[model samples]
Target: MDLAFTPEQQEFRAEVRSWMEAHVPKAPLKTLEGREGFDEHVAWERELASGNWGMVTWPEAYGGRGLDLIRWLIFEEEYWRAGAPLRANQNGIFLLGPTIMEYGTDEQKAKFLTPMAKGELIWAQAWSEPNAGSDMAAIRSRAVRDGDDYVISGQKTWSSRAAFADWCFGLFRTDPDSKRHKGLSFILLPLDAPGVTIRPIRQLHGETGFAEIFFDEVRVPVANRIAGEGEGWSVAMATAGFERGLMLRSPARFQAVAQRLVALYRQHADTASPDTRAAVLQAWMDAEAYALNTYHVASQVIAGAHIGAEASLNKIFWSELDRSAHRAAMSLLGATAELRTLPGGKGGGEENAWLEGYIFSLSGPIYAGSNEIQRNIIAERLLGLPR
Candidate 1:
């Protein structure tokens, strides 16, 4: 794949850099896991939308610049380099928005896309259930038809952003007799709907970035369904591809972390062990490799190529890379890594960003169709191994 950028692309990058340098918040916003932080992040999203940069890959009609995947990558790089606030509505803008654009009715698009871009509505994902974390087909959440409405009743766990999200997109078994991947329907529901309950789950870092949601005969309009009945599995798999391949974990994020890791090592290099230094270097190399691979994948996607099992490979690579980078950071910090609070407010009062990141990285292998499932896909599909 060609690595060179055209003059236009270079100019675009310059424009993005200038905009970010000028407008990114000087102080980092609080984490979006709490109510105060969530509102702060929502404001940031609106600010980004006002500049038409909330979702660059979206169509111009939807408050975007109608940019290509390559430009999106450039935007992400600049965004991270500027240390912008983490997106509060990432589930809406990244995973669900694309699926909606590809499957939603024109009316649905008009109703949802604009508000989502403006951060007027934050979205959470509700896919995993008590018994169906990785084995999604085992989902027991049921949505029974009732005239023009579907009554949903079941429970979903580990829902990211659910604690304060306005809406949710998830899979429900519409056909009670159906098993596995069959008889499923993709649907969107309001979080405040009657009979719905949300309970926050505190992470190891004492943050509630995830939650459990319970639905008890919650009623939603039939119009909220995506694609068609019994097609939820196929639609969700496509979203999963987007999650594992490009959007959910961007290469720019890792590259920025790698740069920080290197800087951290340099600060303590004189006293650092050889293995720690080696790990730091390896992290940087792996981050660069991921970025390059992403460029090739984006090129093919823009050329109308479909990503298959390679998404699994990409997921595995980046998740492990993230964990390894954070682990190296912890090692560099040594005993201080465990300190609830670092001197000079380095760890955000009770915990530092590195320690917080390390905690979050532990979940990387488990989410978005866990690393084990991705490896199985790689072996069975990509490598032609038996299941």
Candidate 2:
């Protein structure tokens, strides 16, 4: 299997590299490793949009470069290489943008896609409720149609970024009597609507990226519905597919982490034992494997392949790998890793990064569909196991 790019692809890589070097911020915006509170992160996203780097895979008409998936991969590689800020609107650009392009109406596309690509609109997701997490079909949020609007009433917990978001996209039960996965509708809602409440959940890293959102008779126009009533499961599944696949966890992200791990290893080499050295080497190798697989996925996507259950494998790999890499970093940091906050009068060193990374990595297996669920998918769908 040839893992090389063509001349055109190589040129695209250089172009993206040059653009990233030119436009990537000179200073770190925020250290959002595990913590949240990044208003500047949104500003950085718009900066990328200004540089035409916000959503390179999106169409040119929608303010993107209209690049192929491979080019998008190249862009991601360069972005990470520059140690640039991660896009604050990843949920919108990575998952919802593509789903809307495929299943949204022309009006929906005209309304959401362009601003999304331009980083003008920020979106949050309300998929996982208190009672329903990995089991999305268990969502009880009701959107009763009343004339021209749907009066939504439910509580959404563990909502990522809703506290600072402009809009929200989620699944709602349009039919009270319909069974699981049926009678659901995908709807877009404004966060500022009356009766919509957002309460932040502070993480171990002292950030409020996660939140609990309550909707009390919040009214959303029927025009904001993505797929028609009773078609939400399909729309949601499509979005989830993208979530597990290359769209969310790009291979370039793993590569960037690997480089960081290498630098961390060098920083504390005197303290590293032979066993720790071996572990670091293994992580480097695993990160490379993830990169190669990402390229394979990018090539398949460029060839117009509709990503499938195999994307679950990547999701499981990266999430677990991230967990392991951060764990190793903590181990390597030893006693110094306990301090999570920045040094005030009492000084903390590089270990704070490891502690924050470790805490952040703990969430990986739980979010984006649990690792257990992904394993089940691999067994039932990929391995032909009985449900």
Candidate 3:
């Protein structure tokens, strides 16, 4: 409960800050399709990998700095403050890497972990389908065992990073007759397999960062299964817990964005009403609260305590705050904001980063278990409420 960082922790923060100031790109990361900006983001990730700061808390064997979780938080703060590229393979490295560390075989670790840590092998999450999204237990994608391989056939929509990823980790119904949560299995498949097809989905913001994937008898090696058949629901749930919680709701990233939003507001205060000033002040307070919550969670994680539903609360707060802050920014920019995409770019700012962020924020309330479901978890499991 002591909130202060130790002397060693403070020193670690200074070290990370110094490293990032030297390496972070001079300009903001470019959205994909931008000439040098996209490449620059990739280069920034590689630069972090080169510094052994890619996955701060992973074991050294997996290409990490071998630091503890507190130090990892410091690294994240510094990375965001320096305006480093967003972790493009976060679905692979943040959510799946930890799952594999706990559940995967040594061979699986040797194959996926190092490459993921080094940013050499980017991955996508192929979980949502035309029918099964928030209700992951309803997944109908099937993978039937065929000697040394499994033939997978189904469609996955909202498959982020599939347009550029080399692999995907997802759930499949290996026991179709077993019903609901009992029939599923977790599996990894190469995206370039002959029978696999990927088509990009253009967002409201004009970005094609997400896609739909079709598996037409796509064959994957039996070695790709993460957990045993019938254990996929638990594996997927566990993964979602991380996705919607501490790892995905990194306070440092949110705080940096919130800071930028504040700066953007100040740059155009003439357009903001007194009510808008109140909204911005509230947002700043919420951002600070989120930072404090994350720091507490980091301390608990570093002390080897298991994170629980409280992480869900953190996700809920930060995601909504992100939306609120961005909306405020767009509102302040007024008519000029309509000039989106850096003046020469097409569409409004709403269609660029803020719009994309707002759309993505909408998904936050739905994914990793909907906010209503998260409330159920908090009420029943955390608060001991009646079913």
Per lDDT, the best of the predicted structures is 1
Could you tell me every candidate's TM-score relative to the true structure? 0.97, 0.94, 0.92
* Residue-wise C-alpha lDDT for candidate 1, range 107-209, written one tens digit per residue: 8899999899888999999999999988999999999999999999999999999999999999999999999999999999999999999999997777798
Give lDDT tens digits, candidate 3, residues 1-387: 577889999999999899989987665566642324445556666788998887989999999878887787788888888877777768877899989988899999999999998888878898989998767678898999899899999999888777777899999999868777888999999999989999988865566777999999999999999978778888887888889777876888778877877887788788788877777777788888888887787777778888877767876787788777767766776775555455655542133565445556666676667788888888888899999
Native-to-model Cα distance after best TM-score fit, residue 286 in candidate 3, in Å: 0.9
The residue ranges of model 1 lying beyond 4 angstroms of the native Cα positions read 346-351
Q: List the candidate 3 regions with Cα displacement exceeding 4 Å.
A: 32-40, 342-360, 384-387
**Candidate 3 TM-score, true structure as reference:** 0.92
Candidate 2 colliding pairs: none
Cα error, residue 153 of model 3, in Å, equals 0.9
Which numbered prediction scores highest in TM-score against the true structure? 1
2 or 3, which is superior by lDDT?
A: 2
Candidate 2 per-residue lDDT, tens place, 212-321, comes to 99999999999999878999999998898899888898877877887898899999999998888887887788888998888888778777787788988988999888
In model 2, what lDDT does residue 184 have?
92
**Which scores greater on lDDT, model 1 or model 2?**
1
User: Of 1 and 2, which scores higher on TM-score?
Assistant: 1
State each model's CA lDDT, in order. 0.91, 0.84, 0.80
